[model samples]
Target: MRIIAIGDIHMAADAVTRIPEIGSADLVIINGDLTNFGGTDDAKRVLDTVMTANPSVLAQFGNLDKPEVNDYLEDLGINLHKQARLLRHRLCLIGIGGSNKTPFATPSEFSETELAAFIEHAYEQARASIDLTEPVEKIKIPTIFVSHTPPFGTAVDRLASGTHVGSSAVLSFIEERQPALCICGHIHEAAGTDHIGRTPICNPGMLSKGGWVEITVNDTTVQATLHDRI
Candidate 1:
C-alpha cells in the first residue's frame, strides 16, 4: 500500500489543493494540525480540499485544532483520533491526537501520565479484533501509529534551541509496542526520521511549508521518504 503523510498545515486548508502534485497513493494520512484553533466549518473546508485530491483520507486533529472539530471529522467518517481501522487484512492504522504538555499550554496538551494512558488505551483498541492467543511477535499484521507529537529525543522533536521537546510517554510506547511505523508532527522545525528499535518514525513537517512524507508498504518492507516541495 502507498501512503502520503502530511503534517501541521495550520489553517492553510487550501494547501491540500496541491496534494496530488506530490504523488498518488492509496491513502492520505494528515498527521495533525489542520487548523489554528479552527471549528467545524474550518475542518470541513480542510476536508473539502483533501477530497479534491481524490484519495481515501484519514486525519487526526492537532493541538492547534479545537476539540469540537473532532465532532465534525467524526461525522464525516474521516477522523482517526483514538481509533483504529484496518487498512488491509494484514495492516492496521491507529491514531492519537493532541500533544503532550508544552510551556505554552496549548489547548490539547496532555500530561505524561495522561498521554501514556491514552496510548495504552488506543493500542488496546487497535488490537481488539485480533485473537488473544497470538503472541505479540507472532502477529503478522503491521501497525502504524499516528500521533501529533514525535517521541522524546528523536531528530524530529528537536527545536531551534537544540532541545528535544517531544513526548516521553510516546517514546515509551514506541519502545514497548514497536509498531512498524510511527508518524508524527507538531515540531515543524525538526522534520525528519528517527528509529525506536526496528520501527521508523517520521515528522513530515508543516504541510503549509510544502513538506510531506511518502510511504510504500509491502508484505516484506516499508519505505518512508520525507520531501520538501514548493
Candidate 2:
C-alpha cells in the first residue's frame, strides 16, 4: 500500500495544490493541524480540498484545530482520532490525535497518564474481537500508529532550544508495543525520522511548508521517505 502522511497544515490551502507528488496513493493520512486556531468551517474547507485530492482520507484534529473540528470530521466519516480502520494488505491503521500539554496551552492537551490511557483504550478499540494472545510480532497483519506528538527524545521532537519536548507516554508505548510504524508531527523544526527499538517513527513536518512523508508497505517491508518542496 502507498500512503501519503501529512500534518501541521496551519491553514495554508496552497499546500494542498502542491501535493500532486502524492500520486496514486491508496490512502492519505492527515496526522493533525488542519487549521491554525480556526473553526469547523475552516476544517471543512481543508478536509474538502484533501478529499477532492484523494478520496481515501483519514484525518485527526491537531492542537491548533478547534475541538469542534473533530465532530465535523467525524460527521464526514473522515475522522481518525482514537479510531482504527483496516486498509489493504491486512494493515491496520490506528490514530491518536491532539498532543501533550505545552506551555502555549493549545486546544488539545493531555497529561502523561491521560495520554497513556487514551492509547490503551484506542488499542483495545482497534483490536476489538481479534485474539491478542499472540505476540504483536507474530501477528500476520501489521499495525501502524498515528499521533500528533512525537515520542520523547526522538530526533523528530527536538526544539530550537535543543530540548526534546515529546511525550513520555508515547515513547513508552512505542518501546513496549513496537508497532510496525508510528507516524507523527507536532514539532515542525524536528521534521525527520527516528526509531524506538525496531519500530520506525516519522514526522513529516508542516504542510504549510510543503513537507510530507510518503510510505510504501509491502508484504515484508515498510519504507518511508521524507519530502520537502523547495
**True-vs-predicted CA distance for residue 102, candidate 1, Å:** 1.4
> Ten consecutive residues with minimal summed lDDT in candidate 2?
129-138
lDDT of 2 by residue, 85-152 (tens): 76753777778888998999888788989889878877776676345666444577788889999999
Which pairs clash inside model 2? Answer: none
User: How high is the CA lDDT of each candidate model?
Assistant: 0.81, 0.84
Alpha carbon deviation, residue 212, candidate 1 (Å): 0.8
TM per candidate comes to 0.93, 0.94
lDDT of model 1 at residue 68? 84
Worst 10 residues of 1 by lDDT: 129-138
Query: What TM-score does prediction 1 earn?
Result: 0.93
The best candidate by lDDT is 2
Off by over 4 Å in 1: 20-24, 135-137
